[model samples]
Target: MRPLSFQAVRSLAAGLAAAALTGGALAAPAAAAPVHAPGPVTEQGGSGQGARLHTNTELARELKRIEHASHGRVRVRSIGTSNQGRPIWYATLGTGPTRLMYVTQQHGNEPLGTESALLALRSLGLGDDRESRALRSKITLGIVVRANPDGHHHGWRYNYDPGADPEYGEPGKGYDINRYHDPAVAPDDNPATEAAVIQRQYAAFRPSIMVDYHMQGRYAFPPPDGREITTSILWPTNDDVSAGALRAAKQVGVRVHDAFTGAGAVVSQYPGGSYEGIARNAYGLRGSASLLVELSALPQERENFQIRSAAISMVDLARAAASGALAGIDPARADAIPPRGPSLPGGSAAAARGAAPAHDAAD
Candidate 1:
């Protein structure tokens, strides 16, 4: 790998320093993933028709709207509060053996996921569509619409914990709560209160499938062999993910990608294996098959479009999982798992070059 330019190193150091001063926490030790180069697209709004939720108060208002639209069929609760005292809300839908949990807005700037979730709830409750009714009949869905209120309110990434440094740019909000999935860091060491609440929810609820929705960084990671879009199915430690779960993850990934690619969205591949600091990984450790859906964070104005597409994709996946289509997926026919290490844009070729390691959470 080429050495980082002096200016790049200096910028990184300055960003790290700012994160330290801004109350962000240091992430646990792990090899860093190579950053992807940025894309050149401009931003655009999505097809949804509603004011976006950009603050805690707006989030609350949107939740109320969903509840009202659902006629109380959906139960919304406060899982916990952010460092800034904003409530982290969770909504429960349906009651089936298959539990699918979704967390959105782990990073404040990526607010569209939350909006999409709310919109999805509205569609489920009000739309008479075949997909909506089918999903309502079979699966139990839990949603954490906004996980980082402090950062969101400040229009930053890290919570206002007074420990994290913010100089590392977008993901460098001092501490990354996504990385605190281990039980050892639980109950207190967690910097974002929202993360702790999510941890507790996973332990208590034990959903069979989990999905974390977030916007990607500036760059796009295209799939190997020129695939259009990508979805990452993460394997947690226990190796408890059932054959059914794996099939479901791939089915959902492929279906979502197809929808986006058909709509002219840039698609990419995200290799699936062990991963850490992510909600999907943490939840997977406890026996759930999890997929982390990342939408490229380019063309700031077009984020809304990405968010809407992702939300629609999520709803479709939920319906598919509820209907038993995903559960019955055959793994053998799915796309071959990328060789271990970096296969996507910005991935580490070194990791891909070696034998695939036992699935670890921090990969």
Candidate 2:
């Protein structure tokens, strides 16, 4: 891919700076700055190959298309409005007793997962296709295509809340909807109106599994046990690494690794050895198995590839979860897989040294 435009690079830098000044914790040391690599280039538009979605408008249009195409077999609902009043769209397919929730685009700038989700919806025949029908026959699917509309529209990471905190810094003023861990703040202290509605929906739905899609820093990291693990899945909080969550994560990881590896891409696990705390973990707190799929983002062009691979991975994971294939994976072994190389040096330690504090709706 062509070098990122000066403006695009500058925007990214600014966003990173803003995040540092905010309340979230940083992962790297002050001297160790995050680096950006050039991304690969690919033709734009969906020319009879896999579909490509890059913008909110396109995502919305695709949702409408799926709704129309499904002919009432699938139902689309507006869980609530974003901070900016944009509709937060979710599509529900099937009516099985078990409920599975998939969310993408919680961070506005990470749009690939959202696109992949749209494609998945269209491909599944909106609950009519044989595969979807079979899966739906066993489980209900709830998908939220975009979680932070305000950030998406502005291409920023946080929601549109403008209330700054002295402890968190100026950037912390806007509500990072993902940080609303407590269910007691106004609408449970969630900064985004849309998040509030979705939280309520999930509480009512009581989904068995929740998957949140996102992109990570571009630079590649060493895998566990000196082996590469592409498509890291953040394990939930349960000490039971062998639990259903970990099993589902591993199955999903294998699928993503295969897809990207086939396409000539290297995949690996998070070097930390276990999943970190985030919105996905929060979901886990509520008795649901939550998985956070983090795609590499350092080489920006890879964003598109990661998005596609993630979509494929999600399909495989969803199918397995629906079919009870993931029932045997133990949560205790969540980090059972070892790293393939020397661990990348960054984490809460790096955050303490000078890396910008973590900021974003998911913080």
Candidate 3:
């Protein structure tokens, strides 16, 4: 891999500053009803804004469009199919040796990651600026913008399959695609088809860094008057993860946390478990520095803000990784970041009292 030139780093830093300034502009809330059909309908595109998220067809079109517009700078292909036969597309941008794989929307209900990923695709694929070209020279980005199309179509957490897998979350509903990524399970043998698709892709890509994007319930930091955590992040914590891998994952977390927090988004370390089945831990066990990023599910009125926060984080990470800045980040800084506080209460009265809501496991 070629080293990032000093000029490239300066240019990337300048572009990131510009992105931070522009990401906060809000769009009108999407008025159309969220699309539910699995037809070839185009998705309501923009920041989330409680809008209908992108459908499979729309994602395909956008990926092809980016590929075409990039004049060969970007490439798109179908890695595999979902349980419902939806085309699971993978888009690639940049050609450098440092491979970064991002899988978004593993849970059907979480739409922000996919949305932000699209924004990132456009920026990296279409921009002809020095920073974009510079980053492209040092890193190759492999993005699976939507990993669970069946689950996404059903507007649920699990993939939509009536055929029960051993790890099925609810009978007749489907499997939580996120829970079936254990490296011990062969890609072809994985019961959850989406997990199999992702595992196959991971094996083929052999990325140095992999980031899983997800969404979690709303929470505030430090109780009353505390700021809402717009994004929470966690590194692989499985006991089997190597010390080198853990440190690299922490370095990734610290770089990302600093980038987004500087853009005015509140970020905290997520309270995630060390389950080997979870993607974060599984990928780490496979020797990739894995990080899981969970965007907060805020009220509908703030959907755009949340989308912007997550999207720019993606862009920033790409630039940092490409510029070799990520390699230099202090892993120790990750430990200094505050852990996410308790979930906000259900009612305004309860929230005012800082009463904790019913506890649920962090996805």
Candidate 4:
């Protein structure tokens, strides 16, 4: 969804942005601020190398390009080093009070969301436009596009030293890097390096909402008659998570869902966050509202016609937060997401191509 409209602030937003930039009316953004100044969308677009997935070299080069293209509006920071010594980076944008952070590709093999984040950067280059101002003037967006560069380089699910190969059962759920970090869950498997970098971002950005993105194969719930879910969303379900935080997460989760469904993605509510070890729950423990969205891996070859609905939802959700609609989302409505799904409304042209009947395991 494009969001209701910025009609209310269309007149004043751009001026406020200019004045904020010139007069320093806004407080200093976090250390990892936006790297580019809102300008022309860089020619080096999307993940540059589609479908093939990016190697470490390719990812590094692109991040640098995004930084340079920000024209100084965005800030790029090397928060920490990954297990293989890759620089884990973050880019910040916008100047609004509502802090937002997007972390993608935590599972090395799931690169779709990372590509989406890159595409989002291209859109963020709009300078002084009313809608752009509406977003930048109301929110601060931070992004960590590659949360698992090492694993991503190895083209495996886990960020293990040498990484896992799909040929061998991809052992330990691709090390299921998502399940580590919180020592309380797995002391032996905790990924202190990557986890620490994320914790640092949490402390500095202090986002009210954070989203972690991933991908899976086709799956359905409620068994026989269940809906085919191309995307599944969930709020942190850690027992100790406060109601306020849970409510906030639910609100964001639902808004993201609505945006995805509105864009015609086959979507569903995730089976609840039974695992506290996941990044969303871990961040929730830090007092920020957090959630995770699992996108169904799509055919990477066709780009133009195959707009990944999950990616569109991700971008729209950020704009929602920027425009302030996300904050008004009802927790009750979010909670209403059944264990199975309401499924995708039929006949929408926005649906992803090649959506198969729900089968196989949930990715």
Ranking by TM-score: 3, 4, 2, 1
Models ranked on lDDT: 3, 4, 1, 2
- Candidate 2 C-alpha lDDT tens digits along 1-363: 122245533443333333222322221112223222112112232212232333455556656666776776567878888766778888877778878888876765455566567545554444345766787778788888878666666555556666544222236535555555334444565555555767887887888788777654433334333432335455454453445555555544444444445444455444432222255666665657666676544333334445445555555556666777665544434454333233234532322221112222122
Evaluation by TM-score, superior candidate among 1 and 3: 3
**What are the per-residue Cα lDDT tens digits for candidate 4 across 1-363?**
233234422322333233224322121112212221011112233222322434556666666666665576666777777876888878777888988888887766566676666555545643557877787778888998788776666555556554444232344434555665452534334444465567666777789988988765545555575766667778887898888888888888877777666555556666644556668777787777898887754433322111244445555667777767766777788776655443334412112221212331222
With candidate 2 superimposed using the best TM-score fit, by how many Å does residue 61's alpha carbon deviate from the native? 1.8
User: Any runs in candidate 3 off by more than 4 Å, and if so which?
Assistant: 1-50, 347-358
Q: Which whole-number lDDT from 0 to 100 does residue 200 have in model 3?
A: 90
Return whichever of 3 and 4 wins on lDDT.
3
lDDT of all predictions: 0.54, 0.53, 0.73, 0.59
> Against the true structure, whose TM-score is highest?
3
Worst 10 residues of 3 by lDDT: 349-358
**In lDDT terms, which candidate is top?**
3
Model 1 poorest ten-residue lDDT run? 23-32
Runs in model 4 lying further than 4 Å from the true structure:
1-51, 162-175, 183-190, 221-227, 300-307, 340-363
Error of 4 at 257 (Å): 0.6
* Weakest lDDT window of 10 consecutive positions for candidate 4: 32-41
RMSD of each: 14.1, 12.5, 6.1, 9.4
- Stretches off by above 4 angstroms in model 1 are 1-53, 128-134, 164-174, 183-185, 188-191, 218-248, 262-264, 271-275, 332-363
Quality of model 1 by C-alpha lDDT: 0.54
